[model samples]
Target: MTSAQISPRTTAEPTSLTTRSLAPDLARGAMLLLIALANIPWYLWGAEQRDLSQHPVDGSTLDRAVQTVMLIAVDARSYPMFAALFGYGIWQLYSRQAAAGTPHREARALLRRRHWWMVAFGGVHALLLWAGDIVGAYGLVGLVLVALFIDRADRTLRTWAIVLTSVLLAAGVLALISAALLAAAGADLGASGQVGVDTGVAEPSYLASVLDRVVTWAVGAPAQAFLTGTIPTAVLVGILAARHRLLEEPERHLPLLRRTAVVGIAVGWLGGAVTAAQHLDLWGIPAALDWGFLFLQTSTGLLGGLGYVALFGLLAARLRRRERGPGRVAWALQAVGKRSLTSYLAQSVLMAPLLAAWGFGLGAELSSATAALVAVGVWLLTVGLACWLESAGRRGPAERALRRLAYRR
Candidate 1:
């Protein structure tokens, strides 16, 4: 191939590992840590009560305190960051695929394969371990993103961003109108449909629930996919961020990042407050009795997600300004981010033995506070393990496998 035919750059700044942000690495590491941390209380609560009603699990005053902090800090931000990162990765991957002149059909096939694998992984996770699986949802949405970008070779990623933003704004308006109409009609609204109460253990077998979930996704996922619009939005944002080298050369982007942060916080708070109000139980079975719970989820997840992007970007800018040393902690976090899948799955599998009824059965036994502490311990351990693996090799096992499958090597 002619030198001029070389693929367009995909990654932010230099398209090399050395130039990439320690921020995305550190941010992703922090995200995985929070994911594990967030799961513990939720797990313990599930053990104590079969249904997921309120988010803040009831416990001792100490547990209550910890739960409150988590609700304010981690819960408000983590998953949104995670989802945004997912979008960023999609941008990086899809752009690279495009630069290669890979046919749209071929690229789409790869995303489909990846999605199916993730669905399988989610199935196993739900059946054997827990039911709150995001991987499947992420994968399902990711597939749509792949399709959207595949044939858009002539368009810049910035254009995609505008399109995504417009769509989100439109969806938000539509959802708000729907909620208002339902409220005016005195219609009882819950997260899903008018359904059974959440009792936790008596809810149903994991298998049955997963089967139902799979079927639901088959039918309803398209609607849900259209509703959230996160995947496409994320891809657009990520591409713009990458093209501008925002994630890499922080000095150049600090001014824009700061502005985004300020705006995001203002908008996010307004959105979060409205969404949070829809929940009858901030700490109880919120999905069941609350009117407009789904509406809240749609709104909050988007608003909070935007806030997280700004927050992380701002934090990264600050971190970059410090000219910090490459310490063990940094190394550990970078390692974990590089191979997040292994750590994520490891947490899911490891948690089964730690809290499941079939194992130590410490689910309900541990308070939310203790669960949070345990989550910290687990995060630290995972960090150490990731560091060790990175020292020994380039990729974590899962990362390697995914790459091999993705490239069909």
Candidate 2:
């Protein structure tokens, strides 16, 4: 172990677009849509909030339908997928450094710096636009996980992942059983008014709203990353997947991808459907059991998120078989994925003004269906921006900035 071996002459450079894998990018590009859908609902400030629900209590049939579908497919599912991908990206970065002859300690320090910058980015994002920002949460988790587990053996990663997942499952089960028992005992556990934080989206004052958003972000980021158990668990599994180059070489793991896609999506959707039923009052579920349903949905969300990742991996494999390569739509989506951070922040940029009460306050005037249309439009706009950047051979501004900060000697 010579000093030269311990410290490479130069650190690894950022990955070039040409060398980037298709599956991860494609998955990211597509999931931004889901993230849009999930976040936009919080902007509907004029609508009546329900206990244990992100959706408003009132809407048209179409709005209800949209809400149902979103609950079943989007809500808790998208972030975990992003978390998995984030973890995978971390591993990719760390490995690239190792391959470039950087020592483990130095490489870890580089990643720590990057993650800290991400936290800063998220804080600014939350303060300026959306309070429900995920960047900080993922960054926070990345910092801890990289320091603790980045050098751990494969078996250790797997063991910890399993332990975390089991804990989530057990928590879900206990919540359900306790709720049922309380309901049977005739405990008055009905709707206890609206749940969730007031993130100043509905506030008429911009300065006041800024305070609200920052406060919400400060509390929610840590709670989401650590307390929920979903993000951390998914992140661990993502590290394991990256270790095997699952996304990078999807063709080599067809059977596993296919099985995970099928089973994971099925279970995730089933859990979400049950929660949706309760939300819609279609199942006549006791209000006492609201937390139970919520727990079930969150617990199963990790699988749903991973299922989406596997599905995209398979899609990437199919694209590889094409003679002309991916079509225009695939290329466009990949562009957005390549510039994902910019595209993601761009959603807040586009929507906050039009929808927030401090701005034009369109959220007060929109229903679920309309809000969804707005989200999709915002996403499409980002797609176009990403495509333009791709054509110009320029990285997204956010990406370029982060790279400069992270790679600074």
Candidate 3:
């Protein structure tokens, strides 16, 4: 169908607050906390050596403990969850358009427009504030996936998801075998690369930091979206789950949700624990095996992310059965989730200026435990801001801007 065939009146408006589902928003709200935890470690710039998890190799007892927990639960896990939610939201937009009688081509066009704007938003975000911006990666992923598979059959989606997941798993196994062989051959595994570098965070000059962040983001964003099997795999699975309305109608799929939560989390945590042990030197693993451990952590992270989704679905189901509505804490989290883009970007605004060397340079002083506290504080402040916006019946500034751009009359 041609674009002219679909009237502007037939375009689906964004989902109103009342019509929104709880599970997805709740998952996103909670996921932001994980995102904060995962990101804050990078700002610990004074560490001489960081492990594959981007955590410092040496710390006090409490710091090590915090790192251990974060490695096992937060690292590599949060992004996949967000990616799955992003994919789910993409389907939601397309399905809403179809319901509004938007032609397939027009619906696709609307999505592309939004995704392109997201890429632009991400680019600006990286250039100005944070190097580890994920918005562009997700936007790029959405563009490709929507173009290629939005109209594909359910079976086709499932087939591709499986194929991609298997490929990731095979690569992980190969890395493990290769690591073992190299170690046996007396290779120096300690020479393997660290997971992250102190490029932008450690640069004392603001202009230099901006250059570093942009260059890192330019290289990292596309690589993250396409090269990392974790994201695409989770996104495809999310698309499949959205087809079944898994999160929207969790009560109908309690058994499936339960099994997924149990099994996925178990496998995910196990993989992370092994990596954490290696990182802490508890396993006495050779440095050469670091790559293998990283592969294992990343591959299982998709499962962990899906598991978190299922857990939130269950939580929503429980909330639905309650006589009273969700409590204030839950309400606040939902508020933040509703304006997630703003909250996410606000995190960078609050953090980079306070922690980076170009700003207050607090990152050089904070330990793992303290850094985690700072991350939580930043998230809480965003929550407060979101709640205020919620009370005023206003959208986040970022959300409003994107909506204005993407849904132009």
RMSD of each: 5.9, 2.3, 1.8
Q: Mind giving the per-residue lDDT tens digits that candidate 3 earns over 1-409?
A: 4464453556789888667888888899999999999999889888755446778888999999999899889899999999999888888888999998887888888888899999999999999999999999999998999989999999999999889888887777687677667767877656555655434999999999999999999999998898868998898999889989999999999999999899888978987898888788775557646877788888888888889999999998988888898778888888888889999999999999999999999999999999999999999999999999989988999999987777765
Order of candidate numbers by lDDT, starting with the best: 2, 3, 1
lDDT at 107, model 2: 88
Identify the runs in model 1 with alpha carbons over 4 angstroms from their true place. Answer: 1-20, 45-57, 97-112, 151-232, 269-289, 318-326
Candidate 3: residue pairs that collide: 189-288
Q: Candidate 1 lDDT, tens digit per residue, 4-57? A: 132222211213334456767776887898788766765563533312223442
Clashing pairs in 2: none
TM-scores, one per candidate: 0.74, 0.96, 0.96
Candidate 3: regions farther than 4 A off: 1-9, 189-199
Give lDDT per model, in order: 0.59, 0.89, 0.87
Q: How displaced is residue 138 in candidate 3, in Å?
A: 0.1
Over the stretch 1-409, how does candidate 2's per-residue lDDT look in tens digits? 6433443345788899878999999999999999999999999999987765789877899999999899889989999999999989999999999998887888887888899999999999999998998999999999999988999999999999889888886787687677667777877775556766988899989999999999999999999989988998899999999999999999999999999899889988987887788788775557546887778888888889999999999999999999999999999999999999999999999999999999999999999999999999999999999999999988999999998887773
Off by over 4 Å in 2: 1-9
